[model samples]
Target: MPSRADPLWRHRPPALLWGLAALAVAVLLALNLGALGAVYRRAGPAAAVFGPADWAALRFTLLQATLSALISVALAIPVARALARRRFAGRRALVVLTGAPFILPTLVAVSGLLAVFGRGGLANQALGWAGLPTVSIYGLQGVLLAHVFFNLPLATRLILQGWSRVPAEHLRLAASLGFGRRAMWRHIEGPMLTRVVPGALAVVFLICLTSFAVALTLGGGPRATTLELAIYQAFLFDFDLGRAALLALVQAGLGIAALLALAGFTLPGMAMTGLDRDAPAAPGGMARLLDGIAIALVAAFLLLPLAMIVLRGAPHLAGLPASVWMATLQSLKVAALSVVLLAVFTAALALAAVWSRRAAPLLEGVGMSALVASPMVIGTGLFIMAFPFIAPARLALPVTALVNAAMALPFALRAVLPALHRAEADYARLSASLGLGVGAHLRLVLWPRLRRPAGFALGLGAALSMGDLGVIVLFAQTGGETLPMQLQRLMGAYRTQDAAGAALLLLVLSLAAFTLLERLIGGKEPRHAGT
Candidate 1:
C-alpha cells in the first residue's frame, strides 16, 4: 500500500484487456444490430414480425427442444445415479466417453444416427426381417432422436457432477445408519436432483433450440424447420433479407427470454476439481441389478451409433473422394485459426474478470452472450453487413473461424477463469512484492499455472470449430466447403458410403485434436504453485 514507486497498472491490466474483449463483443453485436437496422430501413413498411411459415417453424422448434430436454434429463437420472454409486471395470472410461458427443461433429453424429435408424439401416432391417413395419426417422421423431443422442450423455455427466458434490461424511453417516436404497435416494439423490435437474433441463433446451445441423439434415422438410433453419431458408433460398432479419431478431428475442427466465437456475460449474473420492454406501442386490440395467441401456444407446459409423465407414475409407480430403484440410485451417482466436480472447477476458472489480460482471456477461446468441443470427447479421461491400462468399472461411471462436468463448472461459483466478489469488501479492512487471508476472507466474486449463480450453475450441457447419452454410459456396459442408453435400448426392467415410474422418480429427492438446499441453495432473 505504501509503494508509490510501483507502476500504475502493474498489479493488473484490466483496462487494456477489457477494451479488447469489449471490442470483440461490440463487433458481434453491431453486426447483428446493424443487420436488423438495414432490414427495417430497406423493407420500410414491408417488414413483419412473423409469417405463417415462421409460426410453424417456431412451433416445431419449441416442441422438439422441449421434448429433447425432458427426455434427456429424465433418462439421465437413472444412469447418473448408477454412475455415482457403482465402481465398475470401465467406469472411468465410460465417464470420459460421455464427453465425446459434446465435441463430436454434428454431421458425423447425424450420419451415425442415419446409419442406425434410416430406411435401410440396422433397425429397419431388423424390423423387416421380423415382418413388422419399419419406422421413419425423417420428421420430428428424427430430430428428437438426434437431439437426445447428443444431449443425454451431457445430461448424465452434469448430473453425475452434482452427485460428486455430496459430502463423503454424509455418505458415511448414512451407511452407519443402515440407510436402505430407498432412504438413501429419498434424502440424498432427490435433493441433489432437485438442485441440478432444472438447470440441466434449461441448458439442454437452449442448446436444442439453436440446433441447425440436426434440423438441416434430419428434419425431413419445411414442416420440421427450426427458427434458425427458417432464417437460413429465408436468406439463402428465398433471398428475403427482411424476413431473415425478422427471424433472427425473433430467435434472438426467444433466446434472451429463455436466458432471463432460467438465469436464476445457473448450471452447475463444469470445472473438474479433482476432488471426487469414493463414498461409502450399502450395496444391495436390487440396487446393483437396477444400476446395471440402467448403465447397460444407456451405454447401448450411446455406443451403437458410433459403432455403426466405424463399421460402415471402414470399408469406404480407401475410396474417399478428393473433395473430402480438400475439405479436411480446409477444416483443419479453420479449426487452428479458431483456436488461436479463442485462446487470445478468452485469456484477455479471463484476466480482466479476475483483476477488475468493476468490470468482472460485465466481462462475464459478454462471454456468456455466446451461449444465447444463435450462430445463425450472427452469421445472417454479418452477411447483411458485408453484402454491401465485398462478397460474403470470399470472407466465408475467416468469418466462420471468427464466429466459431465467439461461440466457443463461453466454454473456453469456463475452463480458464477458475484456474486463472486461483493463480492470481495465490501469487498476485508475491509478484507485486518482487517488483515483477505485467509481462514478466504473466510469463513467469501465470503461464505455468494456467497451462492446464488453457490447453483444455484451446482443445475445446479446436474441436468445436472443426465440427461447426452453421455459419459456413450462410457464407460458403461450391469450392469453399468445410468438412461438415462436404459431408452434407455427399449426403445430398446419395453418396452414403463416402459421407460415412468423411464423417468418420471428421470425428477422428476432432477427437484426436482434443486429446492431443489436452494431453500434450495440459498433461495428466493439475499443477499448482504450492504443489
Candidate 2:
C-alpha cells in the first residue's frame, strides 16, 4: 500500500510526464487551430465555399465514413468472438496478423486489394473463370471496402477485449443461473458492447473521415473527395495553398470536435490503445455452423490478400535501383530518431501526468482527442505550417521524425503510464526518502522496476514511426521515398509488380527492424527488457 505523506506530487514522475505530454498536445492543437485562421484567410468567407459542391463533398464524406464505420463494426463481431473464445492452431499468429492492417502502409493494402479485387484483379479473374459478372471496385463503395479492411481488425480487437473483460465470475454466475448463450450474452456481452460499440463506431468513423490515399486511389469520381484528398489537390495539383489551407483548417476543426466528443466516451477504462491482450477463457462449442463459417471467412479476409502481398512481390525487387537500399537505410534512420524523440517526449509528459492531477487528465484528454486527427490531417497541417520557413521538406527527415514521434505520443503514454503508476504506487515513499536524482534514479530504480513497459513503449513508438504515413506524405518527394511512399507511387503509376515488391520489402524490413530494436534494447538491459 502507498504510504501517507506521499503528497501526491511529492515524487510523482508519471503524472509529471503526462502533464508535459498534455502540454505538447495542447501546443499541437494551437498550431492546428491556427490553421483555421489560414483557412478563413485563404478561402474568402465560409459562405463562398459552402456552396453546392462543398455541400456535396460534405454529404459524400459523411456517407462514406458512416458506411465504412458500420461495415467495420458489423464485420468485427464474429471475428472478435471467435478470437475471444477459440484457441486453435496458429490462433495467436492470426490475431497478430489482424493487427497488421493498423500499421501496414495504405498503399500496400490498396495494392493488395487491387491485386485481389481490381479490374485485372484476382477476384475479377476468378469471376471470369466461373462465368460470373466481375464487380467494379471504383467508387464510394470501394473506399468503404478499404476502410473496412483496415478497421475491422481493430474493432474486432476492441470488442473481443470487451468480451474478455466480462469477468469469469460473471460467467460462472451466469452458468449457475442456467443462462444459455443468449441469456449470457443478454446479461454480460450485450452490456459490454453497448458500452464498447459507440466508441468503436465513432473512432472508425473518424479514421475513415480523414483518409487520403484510399479515397484518392479508389474514390473514382468527384463524388468522393475527402477533406485530406481535397487538401492534397489544392496544394499539390493546383498550387492553391489558400484553398488548401482553408480546407485543412476545416479538417482540423472537424477532427478535434469529433475526437474530443469520442474521447469523452472512452477516457476511463477504455484502454483501446491497440494492444491485443489475450482473451480470458470463454467456452464455445461447434453448436452453430454459421459461427464456424464466419470465423473461416474472417480468417480468409484477413489472410488471403496479405499472402498475395508476399507472393506477388517477392521476385520483382531484384531489379530496383540502389536508391531503394538507400531508402531502407533512411527509413531506419528516421525510425531511430523518431523513437528517441518519442521516448523523451512521452517520458517527460508521463512524469507530468503522475505529478500533477490536472496534468494527467489533460494529457489523457489530448491523447484521446488525437484519434480525430489522422496522420494525414496532422501531416498536412504540419507541412503547411512548416513550409514557408522550411523549404524542401524532403530533406527535413529530422523534422519529419519529430512530428511522427509526436504523433505516436499518445500510444507511448498509454503503454507507459499504467506501468509507471503501478511503480509509483509500489515505491513512492521509498524513493522520496532515497532522494535519487534523474540519472541515478533511472539507472537504479525506475529502469529495473519498469523495464518491460519502457521497452514496449520504445518498441511501440519505433514501430508506429516506422509505419507512419503522415510525415512521409507531407515531407517526401519523388527523389526520396520511404518504402511505404515508394509503394504508393508505384501503385499510383500502375507498376503493381514493383509496388508488390516494395510492400514485401517494407513488411520484412519493418518487422525485422522492430524485432532487432526490441532485441538490442533487451540485450542492453539484460534483466527486465521485454520481447
Indicate the residue-level lDDT of 269 in model 1.
47
Following a full C-alpha superposition, what root-mean-square deviation does model 2 have from the true structure?
A: 4.8
Which tens-of-lDDT digit does each residue in 196-276 have in candidate 2? 887788878877887877887898878877777776766667756566665655666776776766767754563333233
In order, candidate lDDTs are 0.83, 0.70
Model 1, 1-531: lDDT tens per residue?
Answer: 637444335355747776886776675566456546765565557756687889999999889989999999999999998888898798888877766888899989888888889898889999999999999999999999999999998899779979877877678778999887789879877777877888788878888988999998899998999998987887778878778778777777777777776776764543323334456754768888999999988888788888888888888988998999989998998998998888778877788778775878888877777666767767776777788999999999899999899888877887888888778778877777788888888899998888888888889889999999998988888888999999988989988889889988988999998988887778787544532
- The collision pairs in model 1 are none
| Total residue pair clashes for candidate 1 | 0
**Residue 241 miss distance in model 2 (angstroms):** 3.2
List where candidate 2 sits over 4 angstroms from the true fold: 1-31, 34-48, 263-291, 374-390, 426-457, 471-474, 517-531
